[model samples]
Target: MILKINDLSVRLGGSHILQGVAFDVAETGVTALLGRNGVGKTTTLRAVLGEVPATGEVLFDGRPALGRATHRLVRDGLGYVPEDRCVFAGLTVAENLRLAVRVPSPDFDLVFDLFPELRQRAGQRAGTLSGGQQQMVAIARVLLNPNRLLLVDEPTKGLAPAVVTAVAAVLERVATRVPILLVEQNLAVVRRLATDAVVLEAGRTAWRGRAADLLSDADATRSLLGVGTTAGRH
Candidate 1:
């Protein structure tokens, strides 16, 4: 397993966000974390990364990961692309990527190859780019380094149909190199990339199985995700 979460729980301002959530990510391919709105899907990802105070066992490559600082965890090969696509508005695309280089030699070749538009707009400020282009910068920032696993949240949220397909293709290519723990609501994108699936409900894991199996069961998909198997762009 690339990552493991056992009995993970989180609380903020006296409100429990996650209650004993448990799941595992294989060392290869994509694992989709699915849930409806406000069900702690994003919180689960944050807790694993130590962004919030959490109590539980998070094992990265079978080693205890809790209690470590977020930066330390990131330095230890945990890459994250947040939902908001938090690019520095004032910085150019090239400068945004440069800031993410952790190792002596960043994988510029791979990043440029995956997102050629980023190279073309190297001098363009990230804020001026379209939402999809900004998302590309966010994903490319993490790809600049070598990571054992990636935690990507809502990569396709609010993206156009064409851009969503483009983003999914980039992720599919990236997954061939590193495993990803993805928190996504877009079932179509999920169908295209995810091999394993973990569904969360009200802050706890509700189901775990093959992605194909979950989607094929329309009843389970509707009950848990609040959407039919055909939901989202297809």
Candidate 2:
């Protein structure tokens, strides 16, 4: 396992957001974190990166990872592409990616190869880019560095069908290199990219199994995710 969580819990504003959420992320491929809205899917990813206070056993590469600062975790080879493609609005495309370079020699080749448009629009202001373009910058920034695992939240949210397909293609290529802990609502994208699946219900882990098995069972999909297998299909 590249990442492991045991008995993970988080409380925010005096409410329990995650209650003993636990799962393992394999060293390769995408692990889909599936759940309905408000089930702490994003919170779980935030907790793992130490963006929110959490109590539990979190092991990253077999080392204790809990309580570490977010930047330290990033420096330790954990990459994150947050929800909503949080790009710097004032910065240009190249500048946004430049800010993410941590190593002496950043992997520009890989990032440019994955997102050729990012290179083409290097001088364009990120705020002026379309939603999908901004998302590309968000993902491209993270790919500039080497990472053991990537915590990607809602990569396809609010994107057009064509844009979603494009993003998924980039993610599929990226996953071949680094393991990804993905929080996605789009079942079609999940079916395409995820090898393993973990479902969260009411802030706790409800199911963990092969992605194919979970998606293939309509009853299980409806029960846990509050949607049918066809939900969010492009």
Candidate 3:
């Protein structure tokens, strides 16, 4: 395993946000962290990166990663792409990528391979790009940083279907190099990208198993995910 969370709990503003959330992520595949909104999916990612105060055993490569600063985590081969596409508006795409360039990893070309449009718009200011393009910049910037483990929170949020497909493809290619823990609400994207899943409900893990098993078992999906008539309805 590349990442492990055991008996992790986090409280924010006097409310318990993570109730003993636990999961494991391997080095060669994608693990989807699925849940409805306000169920601690984002909070869990933040807690893992030490962005929020929490008590947990977050082991990365068997070393303690909990309570470590975000920059330290980045330095130790962990990359985080937040739900909000946080590209520096004033900087050009190439500048943003250059800012994250680190040593000992010459995989910058691979990012271009995954996101070819970014290479074409390398000279454009990040803020001028469309939402989809900005997202690519945000993800690509981290790849330039040369991290091994990726924590991606909601890459498909608010994207058009075509754009979402493009981003998913990029993620799949990126997964070939590093493990991913993806927090996603889109069941279709989750089905396509995840090898395994951990379903969260009200800050606790509700179900843990292979994605295929969960998808095949409709009762498990409806029970654990609380899928009602509203789900997948147009």
Candidate 4:
């Protein structure tokens, strides 16, 4: 395993945001951290990155990872694509990417290959780009680091359907090299990218199974995901 969370719980403002959340990501696959709004998806990612105080075990390849700072995680081959892509408005696209690069890496070229629009407008200021393009820049920034594990939170939020499709394609390409722990609300995107599903209900692991299995079962979808029944199966 590349990353493991064992009985992890996060407390923020005296309330438990994540309760006994446990999952593992391998070196070569995608794991979708699926949950509804305010169900602690972002908090879970923060705990893995050590952004907040958390209990229980966070192990990277059987070694203790708790209390490690976010930058340390980055140096240890973990990349984070935050839910809100905090691209610098005054900086050019190239400059924003340069700021996020941790070390000298050929991985920057791979990012441009995945999102050609970034390559095309490398000189343009990031603040002027469209939402989808900005999202690409955010992801490309992390991709430049050559990290083994990526903690992606809500990449497709507030995007148009076509833009979501395009971003999903980029994520598919990224997953070929990096193990992605994707926290997303869109089932369509999850179904496309994830091999396994770890569903959260009020910050707890309500269900864990193959993405195909969860997508197939209407009852599980209704109970855990609050979605209407559908006939789709991965």
For each candidate, give its TM-score against the true structure: 0.98, 0.98, 0.94, 0.95
Candidate 3, superposed: residue stretches over 4 Å from native: 104-106, 228-234
Better of 2 and 4 by TM-score: 2
On residues 1-234, what C-alpha lDDT tens digit does candidate 2 reach at each position?
A: 999999999999999999999999999999999998999999999999999999999999998899889899999899999997889999999999998899999999999899988889999999999999999999999989989999999999999989999999999999999999999989999999999999999999999989999999999999998888777454
Order the candidates by lDDT, highest first: 2, 1, 4, 3
- lDDT for each residue of candidate 1 in 133-234, tens digit (9 for 90 to 100): 999999999999999999999999999999999999999999999999998888999999999999999989999999999999999999999897777437
Which rank order by TM-score, best down to worst?
A: 1, 2, 4, 3
**lDDT of each model, Cα atoms only?**
0.94, 0.94, 0.86, 0.86
**For candidate 4, what is the total of clashing residue pairs?**
0
Candidate 4 lDDT: 0.86
Q: Lowest-lDDT window of 10 residues in candidate 2? A: 225-234
Model 3: lDDT equals 0.86
lDDT (C-alpha) at residue 13 in model 3 = 93
lDDT for residue 47 in candidate 3, whole number 0-100: 91
Model 2 lDDT, residue 232, Cα: 40
